[model samples]
Target: MSLRSRTAGAVLALAVPFALAAVPADAAPVPEADPFVWTDLTPTYTATADYQYEPFAVTDGYRPIGRCAQGTGTGEGGAGYHYVNPAHVGSLDPAEPAGLLYETDSNGGRALVGVEWIVRADNAAGAPTLFGQSFQGPANLDGVGSVYTLHAWIWKDNPSGLFAPWNPTVTCP
Candidate 1:
C-alpha cells in the first residue's frame, strides 16, 4: 500500500473506537434536570454542644439540623425550603459542623432545616439510613425511572394564621 494510504488507514482505525463511543443520535438523551430536584432528599442544621433549639431521637452529642437538597417551594413567604439528611450529620452538630446541611431557601429564607434520611428514590421499601446526621442518595436511584417527594415541615407559633401546603417545581434527571 502507498505510505499516504497506510497513514489514512491507521488514522481511521484509531478514530473508529471514539466514534462508536460517542452518544448515538438515535439514543434517547438523558434529561438535564436532577430527578431529585424539588424532591426532599434530607435535612441538616447546626446546634450548640447542648443541642439546644434542636432535638432528635438520639442525644449522643450530635445535632439533627442538617441541610436539605431542595425546597418544597418558596418556603415561608417566598423563601424556598431545603430538606436535610440527618444521617449525614452522624455525630456532629449541624450548627458547628460547616456544610452539615444542604441548605436552601425556606422560612422567608430565615429558617433552615434538614431530614434524617432520604426515602428510597421510589420510596419503595427501606428503614432509612442515617450516617450520624446525614444521608446521600444515588444520582439516579431508579436508573432513570426514579422520582422523589419533597416532604417539608411547616411551623406556626401562633394559631391564628391560615395554613397551606408549600409546593414548587424543580428539575429532575
Candidate 2:
C-alpha cells in the first residue's frame, strides 16, 4: 500500500475508538465514586420526634421502617434506621437508592450515614449492580423479602470497605 494510504488507515483506526467513546454533553454524568457526597439528605428525614418519626409528607418517597440495631451474634456493626422508598426498590440507578441509612446517638440525634440499593431476587433479571459494585444477597432481609442489597458508606467511613454490608462506625441508639 502507498505510504499516504497506510498513514491515513492508522489515523482512522485510532480516531474511531475515540469518536465512539465520546459522551454526549446532555448525557447523564457518570456517577461519582461517592454518590452520596452531593446528595442532600434533609428531605429524607421525618418532620417530628427527632429521627424517630416517619416523614410527614414522604416527599422523596422514602419512609422510616424502623431502626435496625446491631446484630447480637453477627459480629458486624448495625445498618441503623432504614428509610425505604418502595418505588425505587428494584431500580438500578445509583442516584436512586432504595434505602437511606441513619445512625442515632445517645441523645436521640440522627445522622445520615449511608445509602442502600436493594432488588428483590425474583424481580431481578440477574444480580443487579450499581456504582461498579455488585449487590450482596439473595438472602432474606427482615421486612423486605429475598433480595440483593448494596450499602455505600458515603457519610460514615467504613473500615471494611465502601460497599460493605455493615459499617463499624455505625450504631443504633
lDDT of 1: 0.28
Global lDDT of each candidate? 0.28, 0.62
Top TM-score hit: 2
Question: TM-score of model 2 relative to the true fold?
Answer: 0.62
Q: Which portions of model 2 miss their true places by more than 4 Å?
A: 1-58, 72-75
Q: How would you encode candidate 2's per-residue C-alpha lDDT over 1-173 as one tens digit per residue?
A: 96544544554454334333443466565443233422332222211112222342156577777557575645577888888788888877655678777787656755667778889999637678766677898867667788899886655666666678888777665
Q: Tally clashes: model 2.
A: 0
Name the regions of candidate 1 deviating beyond 4 angstroms.
Answer: 1-79, 86-109, 112-118, 122-147, 150-152, 157-173
Query: Positional deviation of 27 in candidate 1, in angstroms?
Result: 53
How much RMSD separates candidate 1 from the native structure? 22.8
lDDT for model 2 comes to 0.62
Error of 1 at 7 (Å): 78
